[model samples]
Target: MHPQIFGVLLLALAPAQVFCIFNRRTWGARTASSPLARFDGPASLVVIHTTNTNPCSIPSMCKSVVRDLQIKNIASNSSDIAYNFLIGCCSGVYEGTGWDYKAPISHNYKDPAIHVALIGKFDESAVPTHMSQSLRALISESQLRNKLKNSFTITEHKSNSSTRKLMVKNFLQGFAEYKEQVNDLLLPEQRAATSTTAKPAVSVPSSKPSSPTTFSTASDRKATFATSTSKPTTAKNQFFYT
Candidate 1:
């Protein structure tokens, strides 16, 4: 090739390479670091909910949704890394949602939700099996790790309780749904064979667990934990959200 042409080609390709580096978060990419604020937690499960966003959203735009989730989840004041996993429309795979500051962009061992997308925008009338396949696989893996049953309980995002235990219970319900949705993605035969029959309900203890150090809430948080004693209406309900 001519030297001049080679230089021009490299210049053109440079833009394409930068685009890939920014857009794809699977092999690992990221935008601003704040929205990914949840990476600092010890949580094990990922909850994925597909909003009815404009289907025309390109990959870069879709990442904005991720940033939004991180913002809301943190704004809601839950643990960082709202979910340990994320599955979306890319190739056939799952991507870890939040990241440790150490593993900023790429998903080698640091990320979870490997090789699958749980949701994708498709023709309403006919959906591809890939969506369910990835979804259920991710769920099953989460459940197995938690040692929970396949058909466990799940709460709608709206579910709430006056107490922290109830809040945890509600979160667990979401966890169960995450497990079921992913596990059900298996082939019907596989689902039927692998799926367990008796699933458990929300497993909250009758009383609150031992209280941790408490702090007062700002406008964002409704409840704070200081003293162990609490009544539904008395103690603040400010610690968390849906």
Candidate 2:
């Protein structure tokens, strides 16, 4: 090999870096009466969400938040927590439905998006530095674990038309930066040319057999749905947690 070309190749092939797995536990989770359905198929979208609950920076409070969410989801007759992972302000990541497993989350389009949520609301307060960093890290790990292509779209919950009420207001503006950061981790071909958050949502039919999935709102008591015959349709931009 030519000396100069070999040196260039060495520089291009940097050391592969892997992040530490966040601590995961299910003690606070309410077991779903039935095993979670298999949704571990190939994914290319990641949806970000906030509990929209009181912000809890403390670890104990965060655990309770997770517990309550699981309880709420189960009571609503969901198979389990609808999201694949949840992050506390300081507590790292808590396992939810987990990867490749179907989460009964997305509203309109549901081809290939994975759902991830934060423990507290971020519409008003900035997402703490720790939480934001960890969220990105977790997403990166998720893609690697699922063997997904390096780049996947990251979107906020409110981006969906029917679920605008579920939006985390303050956090919406910063989604572009988040998208850039996520793209930075991708290989050249996989990097997104632009953030897809502002793009209008294209609603199709509910991918699952049930009615359109609803985001958990503050006052929604009966959020669960029985079986429905809604047809499935694909959105223009297949996104996270569609």
Candidate 3:
């Protein structure tokens, strides 16, 4: 092969090789207390979720949040963190149960779906561009690795009957915004359906809103955590969308 042609090919492929993914070790994730089941085949669906907590952007803080979540999951009797991958607000992607494992949040052991949780409460705000880009990159990486199907469909996690009434509207609002933001990343059929379908109208409660919470970016050193004084909202709150 000609040296010049080889150099040109490498330059063309460089961007595709630049994705950053933080592995379990990077975040000091714990071993699952219980045995984890492996996925039988590549996932065909990607379920989006929000942590419903404060967003973390800095690498150190994001790692701490992920570690805490893992510990919380284990304490709740879950084998490991429920989601397959988590996209940090600014810190990039953090691996959860990973590609080959069947996350406990899935409908069943045989369910062909990859669950991805975005760090932070997105119910009332748009997902930050950095986080969305990381998510897109992660999805592309999953497809390249054969862990996710090229034609995978994306959907937001919906709560069950008990919480659905209180949470669905909030989640749908975020999902609508998210869907629009990532439209270009979707498959042709998915994009067509989204464009044709009208987004549902969400009614905002007349009650006084809670005080606004601030999020830290990659440059910020201090972080503010959301307080429990605020009313509970949707996503990854005990229900896993199948």
Candidate 4:
């Protein structure tokens, strides 16, 4: 093999490295309390969530928030933390379960999805734009690293049946705009599922064939009529013609 050709091939085949945006140590993730296992590449969906009671926007407050959650997760008899990532309004992003990790956090049934959560109560307070964008960037980079299809899903914890308690209040409104940025990354099946359930297309019927109007004069306007005892036919209305 030619040296130039070999060098070119190596460059083309090498996997691109992904960098973390948030400072893990800054957010006080000293170490994993328990052993952490890595998951296989390219998660199908990225689930957004927040703490149940705390909506702390300040970075200082987030240290305790992460600490407390870790302790609680361990107390619950679960290994390490439940989420793959955590975002604070001021803290950027903190490593939770870490990338390529299958968080014990369940979505739909016991299915594990890539999970990212804001540290504060987004339901009451708005999610900072920086926090939102950082989350998007992180997911986008991860998708590239894992060689995932362009299509992926953005969801909320409340969307998960088992983790309703981890709901990030009022986050959907902002999430709408965030989803658009990564819309192209969504898989074909995801788009097909959306189209299948979309509102039925509206159909307008052509005007009915016109009927000529004619009137007959009554007998000197004194014609008497006997009431007929007949049942009227009930026909369902059709709006369009095939």
Which one wins on TM-score? 3
**Model 3: per-residue Cα lDDT over 1-242, one tens digit each:** 10011100000012222224566776778888887887755776677777666788676778898999998888998988888888776635677887778778875322387888878765556666545445555654555556776554566654333243234333333322232113343445445433323334333232211222111122123322121212312121111111
Cα displacement (Å) at residue 154, model 2: 0.6
Q: What digit string (tens of lDDT, one per residue) describes model 2 on residues 106-168?
A: 433344667778776544456665455455445444543452334445656543332332334
Off by over 4 Å in 2: 1-26, 159-242
lDDT of each: 0.29, 0.47, 0.54, 0.46
Instruction: List model 1 lDDT by residue over 162-191, tens digit each.
Output: 242233233344232433332333344444
- TM-score of every prediction relative to native: 0.30, 0.57, 0.60, 0.54
The 10-residue segment of model 2 with minimum total lDDT is 5-14
Candidate 4 Cα errors over 4 Å, as ranges: 1-35, 107-112, 159-242
User: What would the TM-score be for candidate 2 when compared with the true structure?
Assistant: 0.57
* lDDT for 73 (candidate 4): 79
Clashes of each: 19, 7, 0, 9
Error of 2 at 196 (Å): 11
Better of 3 and 4 by TM-score: 3
